[model samples]
Target: MTDFYDRAAAREAEILSDALAAQQRRARNGLGAVSALACEDCGASIPEARRQAIHGVQRCVGCQTVQERLAR
Candidate 1:
């Protein structure tokens, strides 16, 4: 019984790890496809540094701040 429980725990851990890895990969791929031409909300030009720092960002810093505040 103890051995079976150990195996189950190991399997659960592996599944969790795989799911986390897959999520990370999807996030990276999604970010890579995002173009940093302009902010979707304000139409401001997104800075190169900002674009590089944030993956899949659609809004400029100012606009994003406002959006976060409003969400709360």
Candidate 2:
């Protein structure tokens, strides 16, 4: 019983470790870890509504639209 419990705990720890690694490797919006005060591409002030709508938005609507177009 004790061995089974130990194995379960180990499995839980491994799952959490894998999740943390995946999150770290993820590329957050150009803002990095936190939301930016200004657009990363144009230096325009990021609006409160946009920031609230997209937790880590880094670009203003115009800049973001341009970037999306360029990507396409």
Candidate 3:
């Protein structure tokens, strides 16, 4: 009985952890119009599919990737 309760508690913790992570990701993604994709540096045309695939995207994939790399 005690083992079962411990397992349930662990599962609840896991679920809550996952929910918190998902919420954090959603918050980071932001909300914005799905307008034409543009480069952050030069206003270049970003592909339509790319814009559709990513949420709240502001920069081109190239620029975005570069920024990510630099961030790391």
Best by TM-score: 1
Worst 10 residues of 3 by lDDT: 27-36
Better of 2 and 3 by lDDT: 2
Residues 1-72 of candidate 2 have per-residue lDDT tens digits of 579889999999999999988776664433345678999988999988888767778899999999999999
Model 2 CA lDDT for position 39: 98
Per-residue lDDT, model 3, residue 40, is: 69
lDDT of 3 at 44: 94
Worst 10 residues of 1 by lDDT: 28-37
CA error at residue 51 for candidate 3, angstroms: 0.9
Give the candidate order by descending lDDT: 1, 2, 3
Candidate 3 matches the true fold with a TM-score of 0.54
Candidate 3 Cα RMSD (Å) = 4.6
**lDDT digits (tens) for residues 28-54 of candidate 3:** 666554545677666998888877777
> Whole-model lDDT for model 1 versus the true structure?
0.89
Tens digits of lDDT, candidate 1, 1-72? 579889999999999999999999988787767756799998999999988888788899999999999999
Q: Rate the local accuracy (lDDT) of all candidates.
A: 0.89, 0.83, 0.79
